[model samples]
Target: MAVPVPRQRDTPATESAQATPPAVAHATAPQASLTLLVIEDDPAGGLTVPEILDADRHRIRLRTARNLTEAARLLTQDVHCILLDLSLAGTPGGSGPGAGPGTAGAGTAVADQLAILREVLRIAPRHAVLVLTAEADAERAAEAVRVGAQDFLFRDELDGRLLSRAIRYAVERKRADIAQYKLAESKLRAQENARLERGLLPNPLLEGSDLRFAARYRPGRSRALLGGDFYDTVRTPDGTVHAMIGDVCGHGPDEAALGVELRIAWRALTLAGLCGDDLLSTLQEVLEVERPCEEIFATLCTVDISPDGRRAGLCLAGHPAPLISRPGRRAQLLPYENSGPALGLLPKARWPRRQVELGGAWSLMLYTDGLIEGRIGEGRERLGQDGMVEMINRHLDRGLSGEGLLEASVTEARRLNGGELTDDVAVVLLSRTDG
Candidate 1:
């Protein structure tokens, strides 16, 4: 029978011996009945452990292991904490069952004494661990805690009450450490997303032009700030304002990255004086080279408003035509005749630029297919171009313009679907007022 060890008062402080582990915020509640795994060198599994009881008087379950191998095999998800005997660290047969003869002879006295506890930590990093030692080995016990154990125990002062309290405290502290790690990880991810959003979204270069530009973009993926939809607006040296919008085939990070590449290439080519079929062909080549696979493609629409704001050139590559609204007439889709296939679909596809008459003082809205693909109700009916036109007309009738108009339109689209749309959406409105 194992004698009941008396509790000691004023144990030496272990803080000065080693750096304390960071205190993490407590995110999860403590377990009801804790399970403790005790690792010792007694092959008979005869380690005497006090019957530990929790705050609610529930007896804590116990499991014992004679070596590191057995301890590792017994370390299951249900085991909340570990009680390791420091003496096992130096036992010749306790290095582990199958551990080579050289394994025990490799480290210094202190290293060998802590090797067992180190192995336990490696196998069960997330679980709380407590080290057990004799009263004479108090310094080494403190060193065990510094190495990674949640706390150290002196066998001389071992009792049911002290052991129970130590187990509870160690479990809680481990939970807080995990929660803090997750919180820090989440914060870092958020910061990275914000940077990506700013880089992916377009900044209109409408300086020295009378065009009033407004845009709205929402990624369909949860917790994502950007998607495969991209757009840009810029005024050239000749005073012609050019705007373009496009969508890649997928809604993943790869697709989004490809969209950014295409947008940047378009802006560079446009500034370099490439337009119409010449521009589209170069962009198709870029897409063919940059896309991850042959099946990936992008639909595009581009509009260049003449300096006078009375005439514009429109080109579509398997993309939706922009909606045009004037002072007197209701909003209508511009002619999409002579549109070519989406980029990467046809090797020698030609996107022909069609001339359109944009009477002075009009608003042109260009968007991806995500806007018109949403269901209006539970029926099979979709909010197609006609529905979107109707919605825009309603918002315009309410005297909405610029930012307000774009926000209201997107909001209404989401509301009509009864929830968030499952595809990325990008919309750009360029309004010109001829004085």
Candidate 2:
């Protein structure tokens, strides 16, 4: 025998009614219309749902499922909310259609009821859910809400207006929950990217060296902190400062990761006293093993400055030559003749180290090709090495040095192209001042 319970009425006078109507009104305007799915085993037609209208005066569509199996089939994207009857059999034992094995106590009816709600939650994780129960089972109804239902309803108090309002409120609340989850995920990703940037782009190791170092790096990918271009400057114990700049073949995370690996490898090998062709050869081996494909390769430019700061060793492996500027002299590119093929391209490649005289008080700029790949205008003409040298000369004439020079150069390059360049750009400047 079923005990008849007092019906609970949610009206303007009730506290629950006060909080729900405002949310329903706000959510209804944007949604315009909604579909509600009702799951119940009552073939006797004990439940009656009247015609429902949203805030926009549009009818709310309703679908009924005799069981969870049918409910799963009807649970499409258009369905915004689900209403499940708590009296369905087999819910406690997890034998109910589409329900996982029950982990709840088997004998208690209350546990069974909650288990049904849990199954519905598992099935429709994204959709808002409500439970229908006897008016006397108010405690169980509240428990259903705690178990993940958006709201619960007493069958005796059910009416079209109340159910419609509850549906709108539940859908809006679910949407807000999803939005907050995504916001938190985005913040976590940002924090992770910051840590990754620090690891990938380390500070220059130039202690005890009189040379001044400045660098500029910009990834072609939108909203990226690192790119395929990588550079590093370190002064070893031998009083020789090693500077390197390189570019992987593509503009993506994989390429950026490869660039970081190469940079770290270069630093390790440089500190270990490897130089010229030997250093380049070891880096090529590393690339061949770590690269995703055989076709991937990287262009490299390395400069080893002498202890006296009056000379340097330059090595170019299928990369552009560095620009050298001295006081009262025009900026020009270091000779790139007799350069070896890019890393991972030629087997047993020999990268010749060219010793060049760096007169006192000179600045050397080593860069990736992205610096010169920008177009001069909307036309097909690129800002070639000649144009870049001219631009640097103009900036130098204005007394811009160190970081200011690199910033002005990159800014002017972007301005000339009328927008951002489509490749990763890295420019490193090593300057020495004589007392």
Kindly list the per-residue Cα lDDT of model 2 for residues 276-388, writing each as its tens digit.
88899999999999999998999999999999999989899999999999998999999889998999998788999999999889999999899999999879999999999
lDDT of each: 0.84, 0.84
In candidate 1, position 414 carries an lDDT of: 90
Whole-model lDDT for model 2 versus the true structure?
0.84
Candidate 1 ranges beyond 4 A from true positions: 1-32, 44-46, 91-107
Which structure among the candidates has the greatest TM-score? 1
Positional deviation of residue 36's Cα in model 1 after best superposition, in angstroms: 1.5
Q: lDDT for model 1, on a 0 to 1 scale?
A: 0.84
Q: Single out the weakest 10-residue window by summed lDDT for candidate 1.
A: 12-21
Lowest summed lDDT window (length 10), candidate 2: 11-20
TM per candidate: 0.84, 0.80
